[model samples]
Target: MKIQVLSSLALVLALLSQGCVSSKKYKDLEASYTQLQEKSRELNQKYQSGQQDLSGSSSRVKSLEEQIASEKANVAALQAALDKCLNSSSQGNVNISKLVDEINTSNKYIQHLVNTKNKSDSLNVVLTNNLTRSLSREEMRDVDVQVLKGVVYISLSDNMLYKSGSYEISDVAGQTLAKIAKIIKDYQGYDVLIEGNTDNVPISQTNIRNNWDLSALRASSVVQALQNTYSVDPKRLTAGGRGEYNPVAGNDSEAGKMKNRRTQIIITPKLDQFMDLIGKAPEKATKAE
Candidate 1:
């Protein structure tokens, strides 16, 4: 665009020197310049948007790591203090009031963790209900939406997501994922894991080494769709394969094998809020605040 603009200006200067510029040619140059500017703006905007997403993801992961470190430090400090309290008591030099206060503080910290866990659990319930309401009866038949251990799991049959021995997502699965993406965007702080599961059947596909390769590829395919097509955060998304293991049912029966061959999308909200409280528990400044 700059080259084109410079070339246009040079042409105009040359024409002006020769006193032979035409109104039509000048107007054409102006229109071309306008279009170039618009294109440049659009490209710049896209570049900035991509940078923002990258920055946001990196910062979030970094913050989570810091919180984990802080939480560990807090836990260690609490343990040391508790041990000191016990030692003092054993020596018959106990301060009953201080001990009681410390025990009460420990109980409060434990309750805080429990409350945060309950909040995640409640979120799973809401997510499950929302998924139940979103999927149609036919769609539900192809997938099972459940909440377990504060995570939302959406299990889809391999047949729905791919052809026999293939890792590509089918059109039906793509549509279902699109719907899921809408729900994902509406929520926040979720770490999603796409796990591909396979049955005990041996694979003869030359491209795929074994069930492991096929399953991992399938999980990766879904992750790509969610990240590229649906704009899910790359940092929050994980892809994995559980090949011929962790089956929901027995592999001896065809029905059971069919159930085993599936993709499960698990969404768990980040425990950052809880971690923050725990991380500051041993801090004097935090206590004062």
Candidate 2:
């Protein structure tokens, strides 16, 4: 019995020791499992961080690439504009040269016109001087010579040219007419206009009707005398009449009436020459085509 009791006690002690060792081993396994779960959580956090950094890098790379593409397109556009300018540079130079030539031509034409005007003015002055020098004081009293607007106007009083109320020229007028014809003949480039002016008195003479008819007949007679008797060129003469319409003074007094009755010989540069000069520029331009 004593031996059996001792064996039972030993068995109980051994079983208790085995249970303590198993409990210690289970605690160690639980600690190791907790450490492994902590390590796993840390690894997951690192992976998520790496994914976010990669996404940000991709976005930055795409932005840089898009910027580079835009810059390339801008450079291409600038190159195209430069090429276009180079292609058109020759045409621009030609247009500029043509404009310069046109401006030069216009300047030359304007200078030509100015020279012609100056020549005409000088001729008028010379003609006026010659007429004034040729006339005597007595002749000047009957004749008035004036230069107005590049024209020479020689006014002869009716008393010196014709009898009272007559269109026929007086015999004394022949000498003056001959001198005037000589002057007219000297200026072959000028044209002469014989204009008759009369007072407002009505005419009752046979073969004459009114002031108009008398004025016209008087102008015609002077023109014919200048052509036939004085040997002035008929082609250079023009006849006209002004029946008291153009007056130098008031017609209320006898002196004014006498002043109103006169004949005017107007000498001017031939219009044909001026017209031909004016037309020449356009004709030259047309021929340039």
Candidate 3:
């Protein structure tokens, strides 16, 4: 009976040992499973954070693309505005240049008129001074020379020039006319007018009908002496008869009638060049083309 009891005790010891080993293994497996669960949660959290960052980055990229597109459109518009502004500025500059040219052309034409007038006035001064100094001879003492209102008036007594009721000039009168012709020839550009005057008288001679005829014939005689003898230009001379009219004082006095018998020479400058430049500019330009 003692042997049978020991065998049963050994069997019970083996069963207890197996039960303790099984409990230890179960605890170790549970700890390992808990660690694996913690690791899986950490991994899932990292993936979720990565996904959120990617989504935010994509939205930012789309916004940047839209901004770039809007900036390109604005740049195009600014470029067009710049080109148009430059074109208009160029045209405005052309118009300003053209206006300046027109003003300069007008100024040139106006200056031409002023130059021509000054030249003419200077010539008149030269002519007036020339005649005053030349006719200061002793033989020409009775001859009167005066420039009245730019016209030269020369007066001589009829007693010194011709006989009464006769249209014939004396030798002294011919010499005086020769001196006048020399003076007129020295300077050019003069219109000479010779006038004759007679006192209140009636005449009926050969080719002498009245006082008018005598006056005309006497004027003609003086003109012939100037042109034929002294080489004065006939084209520049004009003869007229006063016939007791146009007396300086009165026909009742012989001295007044003698004073009225005078000759005039008027000189005038030709303004054709000045007038053509001022009045016919368009025609001149057309001809130039």
| Per-candidate total of colliding backbone pairs | 0, 0, 0
| TM-score sort, best first | 1, 2, 3
Error of 3 at 245 (Å): 2.6
Predicted structure 2, TM vs. truth: 0.61
Q: Is candidate 1 or candidate 2 better by TM-score?
A: 1
Best candidate, lDDT: 1
lDDT of 3: 0.59
Q: Is candidate 1 or candidate 3 better by lDDT?
A: 1
- Comparing 2 and 3 on lDDT, the stronger one: 2
- Summing lDDT over every window of 10 consecutive residues in candidate 2, give the lowest-scoring window: 280-289
Candidate 3 on 90-140: residue-level lDDT in tens? 556666555445444434434443444445444544554455445544444
Query: What is the per-residue lDDT of model 2 for residues 1-289, given as tens digits with 9 covering 90 to 100?
Result: 3344455455546656777547665565556556666676667656754564454345534544554465455545555554565578555665555544554554454455445555776676677667666776578689877665556788999999997778899998987888788889999999999999988767788888788888888899899999999889899999999877888988889999999999999998898985776576522533433
RMSD of each: 16.7, 51.2, 56.7
| Pairs of residues at least 3 apart in sequence or in different chains that clash in candidate 3 | none
* Model 1: how far residue 6 lies from native, Å: 84
Clashes of 3: 0
